[model samples]
Target chain A: MSRQQRHDARVPIALAVLGWLAVAFFVLPIMALVLRVPWSSLSDVITDDATTEALTLSVFTSVITTVLAIVLGVPLAWLLARSNIPGRQFIRALCTLSMVLPPVVAGVALLASLGRRGVVGEILDDWFGVRLPFTMPAVVIAQLFVAMPFLVLTVESGFARSAGTVEEAARTLGASPWYVFTRVTLPATQPAIVAGAVLTWARALGEFGATITFAGNFPGTTRTLPIATYLALESDIDDALLISMVMVVISVVILVALRGRWVGAIGGMR
Target chain B: MGWRNWGYEVSLSIDVKRRIGATQLNVQFTVAIGETVAIVGPNGAGKTSLLRVVAGLISADEGRISWDGMVWDDASSGEFSPPEQRPLAYVFQDYALIEHLTVGDNVAFGLRARGVRRRRARERAQEVLDVVGGSDLVERMPSSLSGGEAQTVAIARALATEPTVMLFDEPFAALDASARAHARRLFSSMRSLSMARLIVTHDAVEALTLADRIVVVESGSVVQIGTPSEVLATPRSHFVAEILGLNPLSGQLRGDELSLGAMSLTVGAHGVDDGEVIAIVRPRSVSLHRERPEGSPRNVWRTTVEAVDRSDGRVRVQLGAPLPIAVEVTPAGFDALATELDGDVWASVKASEIVVQPA
Candidate 1:
């Protein structure tokens, strides 16, 4: 064999070893859970009424939360990435603070600000007869608070990578600011938006502490799969395992579909 | 449709100040109907900055940009039109083709932005693409295009807009030699048909070939403005001479002696003086004779061949020793001088052809 050929052959094998190590690290716990799960009780656990309700609520709230995040987060990402407004850096930092905060801490902060006895909550209850805590809205708000940052961060980075010259060209071509943004800038940044949306939806699906604390984990309203899994873990291991497996399967399916797209989107930008 | 003969009349005076940057583009120039103006300068000489100011991409702190008797930007009067409102199109150096869009779509982008209907915009875009020889690649994305193809698409897209004025920022810089040659030919053909073009390029060949008048800018100022022949015959600044590839040799010409720094060479012509004089000499004018003839036309120097470079169809030989002279010769001259090493060679130049300018 040629000297150069022997050097080139080792690269793929070395990369393959690292890839296997990452896979093993992420999959070992899931593998253990599936192996220990009683196949006989799996059908019974799936048939549980509370489990079905929790699964339905999980999907519903996660979808709603992701939608809300998109509506607010896309504009915020655009502003953070493109604008030279005052205190923009501070606002961007504040948006991503939720990503670093513990879910319980985030729930506490939300409760203090919007609970019935809390500052705005007292006024909302007295003036408008509105109670935000222990509601489905609270679950969505909690999920959005944590997951929206993922979307904003991902999309903002995409915006940062995109050439501003294209936008300038559009403007020179007689496009108004709004037209340039909507037709040119938005389409260019679509892949970033999609990847960010997927990440946010995944994060929303896995939310637990904030939702359980602020929304009170009601079966038909806010008791999502992660909450139900935790509650089931207290009393029944088989049900918890099954619920966990279901969450994993759903997340894995969505992730597998989206991973290729995310890679493709980023690669296209380069 | 053919462009209207709207003779360019813009009285522009710009003064801008920012935190870490400032640009002062204060100059007034006019172009005749269908005239092509070339802004020649190095990067960051405020050439692009001036174009931006005129196009209304950036408003000057204190300036008035009145094009064709219409005020695009008048800071004192608080009149500033956005880039979109201005009837101008710019071809960026990078081509700036929308990567996600097809060539046809990109060309159509400008028309659509101007509120043109979809069908009409596409038809116009197709017409332009045909002119630029890019009709076959209309459906192709920007990623698939070669450099020349992409540049043609960019120009086609710009031309499709049919604006009153077209600004190009080194449009041929990214293209290869053949592509640049083709682009020059394309511009020459479109000169009579298109609107007034303002091309910003450092290439002398591009300027001389495509521009009707050249505006030489350096250090945030317009150094010289003239036709290609005028600028070539007489360059105002060292920058202009360097850019045009003319060797601006400074020397004192007194009586029959020309003092070039420490060295003094005797010339045939005697009427010249001391203090601040530039000698403009073309490389092709200097001859490398085998020996110094008894009677010859003008200045002579015995020098060695420093370096040799082949360009276009000619060979340029760099002379060594007391004075470094770049001399261009044909293939035959090169072949004759090929065997000659780094030894002595007699160099002679005509006295009349050597243009002298004030320092």
Candidate 2:
């Protein structure tokens, strides 16, 4: 073989063994779960009332959360990426903080700020006679809090990497700033936006710790797939495995649909 | 407020000073309608920065930019018009075609932005694309276009706006020789239009051929502004001379004798009384010999061969030391002395061939 091919192929035996072991560590659990799945009754288990309710709730809350994230997060991402605003770095860090924060900590932080007896929550409660905790909206809020960072960080990075010259070229062609943003900047960054939205939706779909902590586990209101899966594990392992398999299938579909864009978004984060 | 030239009036006038990092860009020039001025400079010479200021992409720190008596930017009064409001089009170095849009849509962008109906804009875009020789590319995506095709589309986009001024930054840089020639012909045809054009290019040949007037900038300042012939025959500075591929030697001058450091040459009759002067010598006028040849040439120097570059059927011999200059020779002439080219040689130039200018 060629010299480069020979050099590349000559990996140390110890490293090769460790690499395969690491691969096995990730693959083993998924294999075990797949093996335990009762294929004959899988459809019946998935269509059961509690399972369907949790699945429906997960889909509904995550979709709404994804929409809200795009509405709120895109402008914030643009501001962070393109503006000359003071304290931009600090604001960006603040916006992306939840991405790295533990899910339970994010939930607690959300509760501390929006809980009935807490900071803005007390004012919201007294002024509007509204209680946010243990509600369906609370589930969405928790999911948004934990998941919006993925969208914001992804779109912001896309904006950072896109060429500013195209926008300038548009401006020189008599396009207003708003027109340039809508026609040029937005379209250029569409891949990042789509990738980020999918990532946010997936994160919201799989949310467990934050929903349980802040939103509480109610079958029709706050309980999502992960919450239902956790509760099912206490009584029925097969039902829990079915729910896990559903989530895995959805995740795989999203990854397959995203392909290179998802990998690019993840790489951009690093 | 405007200078009259023939029948048309000067439209764009700029006298600006801007400090970009360490370079202090102080430039002042005017582009009359139907006139094409080329900004020629080395890298980091603020040619692009000057274009940016004129296009209103960047504001000048001092002085005023006015077009047809309307103030575009006046740093003293803090009045500035952004790029969108300027009656101009900028062809960027990379063409900057929108990747998401079809070629037609890219060209139609300026018209659509100006509130033209979509149908009308598309019609106009097609018309302009036809004008720029890219009508066939109208339906194709910008990503699918070749370099020349992209350049044509960019020019079409700019033309769709019917702008009064055109700013181009190395517009032909991405094209191959044949494409560049095509683009040049396109530009020449467009010269019949009344719009003023300011093009920034590092290529001397491009500047000489394309520009009605050449503005040579060095270290963020205009060193010379003249017609191509005026600039070519008598370049003011060593930088300009070097850019024009001529050798410039600065010396003390009195009558016919010019003292170049310890060496001196008998320069032909230059009417201007001079103290310090620069003498420009064309590379082709310089002849290299094995020994000092018996000739009427007034100047002869022993020069070491520093480098030999061959291109376009000619050889350029770079001489080093006491006198550093370049001498051009034919391929056959070069072949005769090919073996001895690495060593020292005698270079001689006639007095009449040297152009003298006040330093």
**Complex DockQ, candidate 2:** 0.68
The lowest-lDDT stretch of 10 consecutive residues in candidate 1 chain B is: B11-20
Tens-place lDDT per residue, model 2, A1-270, is 899999998989999999999999999998988999888789898879999999999999999999999999999999988899999989988988888889999889888989988799999999998889889999999999989998998998888878578999999999999999999998888899999999999999999888898999999999999999999999998898988999989988998999878668646552
Cα lDDT over the full model 1: 0.80
Return the TM-score for each candidate structure.
0.78, 0.83
Give the CA lDDT, 0 to 100, for residue B142 in model 2: 87
> Measured against the native two-chain assembly using Cα atoms, what DockQ does each of the candidate structures obtain, in the order listed?
0.63, 0.68
User: What local lDDT score does residue B99 receive in model 1, on the 0 to 100 scale?
Assistant: 94
Q: lDDT by residue for model 1 over B1-359, one digit each (tens)?
A: 22223543442323442111564565556654478899887776788877777677777666576656667888788898899988788888888999999999999999999899999999999999999888899899999998889889988988888887888999778876456645755676677864677889886656665688999877667889998779988989976765456566778877655678856655433223455555656777788877785687457778898888876788878888777878788978878754456967888877644644335
TM-score of chain A of 2: 0.96
